[model samples]
Target: MTAEIRLFPCLTDNFGYLIHDPATKATASIDAPEAGPIIQALEREGWTLTDILITHHHGDHVGGVAELKQKYKCRVVAPHDKAAKIANVDLRAAQGDVIKVGGLLARVLETPGHTLDHVSYVFDSEKALFAADTLFSIGCGRVFEGTYPMMWDSLLKLRVLPDDFKLYCGHEYTASNIKFALTVEPDNAALKARAEEVTRLRSENKPTIPTLLGDEKKANVFLRADEPSVAASVRMKGQSAADVFGELRERKNKS
Candidate 1:
């Protein structure tokens, strides 16, 4: 049987996802930053929560875990490294570990950057990536706990996935991110088009989740690692790849 995914936006921009397997009628929540929203959404969808796939121990990512666990009696699958902080860890898994929710299987990806203990949950059957803070819609996560290279490598790993893969990032920063991209490379046609489109989408009070990897590659300045324009912009500062990437990221932060 096929699986269905539902997106629940919560707390300004954070997104909590529900992956439901029709085969077994099981549902898993991808990072429960808040219980109220998750609980409400699950109730609306007529789904029962069976598990919580924690990406990291960030408060915004795990704040509602205790309440949700108590309410749903759901299994908490946290990364092996963040077990101590994730709260009520039912299963501790490493990178490449496979976890199940009914007929749906999620492959763990060690994507440390936003946090030292961050991980991503990938469902191969659906080509869906719950990248958390590792990779955003039109931007990458800031380097908080990891260095440029570590984040870069993590992003590269994500970049290799299928072009049509659905990227369910942790936040909705696309509008601001696209604004920053324009400041970085004003001449990028794709970036210009995407920014206009994002403006329209935001105006309609719609969600801009699940951005395709190909669109990010073409429009996202952070993902255009090998483009001549980005390289030239980076080289103008007489810096290394890491330095340039870091600078661009810093610029985005300030923008």
Candidate 2:
């Protein structure tokens, strides 16, 4: 059976997701940005929270974990790094670890760049990727704890996923991300089209989560660092893809 998913707003710009396994009636929250919205979403969906999958140690990402765990007694799966200090973790997962929410299985991918403890969850069978904070629709997370090269390597890991996988990132940064992306790839037709789409979506107050990986690969310049065109846009032509990626990130940081 296919899993049921819900997307709702959390905090100012963060998103909260609930993935439900219909066969087993197990529901896992991708992250607990806030308890109120998650609880409200669960109540509306009529699904009990069975698991909480944390992607990183950022306060906005984990602020409600403790409350949700205490209320539902749900299992919390977080990154294995002890330095993160997230509370109420039942399992600490690293890369290659497979976590099961009833019949649905998710493979853990260590994608540290924004923070050293960051990770992403990929449900291969369902073609769903929960890449909180690591990747956005048209951009990537800022490298906070890890080096630029490390961040680029982590992005490459996610770039290899099948194009059909649906990416559910952590924020509603698509509009701004697109603006910054256009500066780097001004002549990119795919990006221009995506920018218009994003503009329309935001104008109507619609969420742009769950973008297909294929579409992102076409428009997201962060994922196109290796392309000769992208390299030339920043006057880094013939340089390594990693270096081009770093330049793009630096430009975004300042944008």
Candidate 3:
């Protein structure tokens, strides 16, 4: 059976996700920005969280892990290299590891960029990707601890997935990302249209997440480093894709 998923806002811009497998009544939270909101969401859905699947060790992502673990004794799962930094992690996972949420299953893909220990979870059967901060809507994460090439390689991993995959990133950064994306691919019709739609959505206080990989391929400038237009925008035309990507990341850092 397909897993039921719920998304809610947490902290200032962070997003919290809940996935439930009805067959076993097993539910998981992708990241815990805070306990009160996650707790409320669990209660509202009548699902007890049995797992806390972390993508990275960022404070906003793991802040409420202690509270949730105490309340439900949920198994805390995080990246192996950084598990010690995250409180209450019961399992340390790396690339190729498969995690079970009741009857549902997800494969871990190590995607380092925003952080060295970053990883993304892909539930192939459900076509859902808990990308966390690695791959956001219309943008990819900043290369903080990792190099630009490392971040570009990490993004390439996701680019190979089926275009229909749904991306559930960790924050509500679409509007701002779109704005920055436009600077690189001003001629992208799809990007322009998506920006207009995102503008309307934000004006209405709607969430702009769970974006389609297909759409991002066409609209996200960070993913379009291979495109001539993006290269031209940064005056790096004819450069290698990695070089173009590095330039784009540099521009966004200043943006």
Q: Please, what is the TM-score per model?
A: 0.95, 0.99, 0.97
Reference-based lDDT, each prediction: 0.85, 0.94, 0.91
Q: What TM-score would candidate 3 get against the native?
A: 0.97
For model 1, the superposed segments whose C-alpha errors exceed 4 Å read 236-240
Query: lDDT by residue for model 1 over 90-162, one digit each (tens)?
Result: 9987788999999899999988877888889889989899999988877988889888878877887888888
Q: How many residue pairs clash in each candidate?
A: 0, 0, 0
Model with the higher TM-score, candidate 1 or 3: 3
Q: Which 10-residue window of candidate 2 scores lowest in summed lDDT?
A: 147-156
In lDDT terms, which candidate is top? 2
lDDT of 1: 0.85
Per-residue alpha-carbon lDDT of model 3 for 46-82, expressed as tens digits? 9999999999888989999999999998999999886
N/CA/C clash count, model 3: 0
* Candidate 2 lDDT for residue 44: 94
lDDT by residue (46-119, candidate 2, tens digit) is 99999999999999999999999999999999999999889999999999999999999999999988999999
Against the true structure, candidate 3 has what lDDT?
0.91
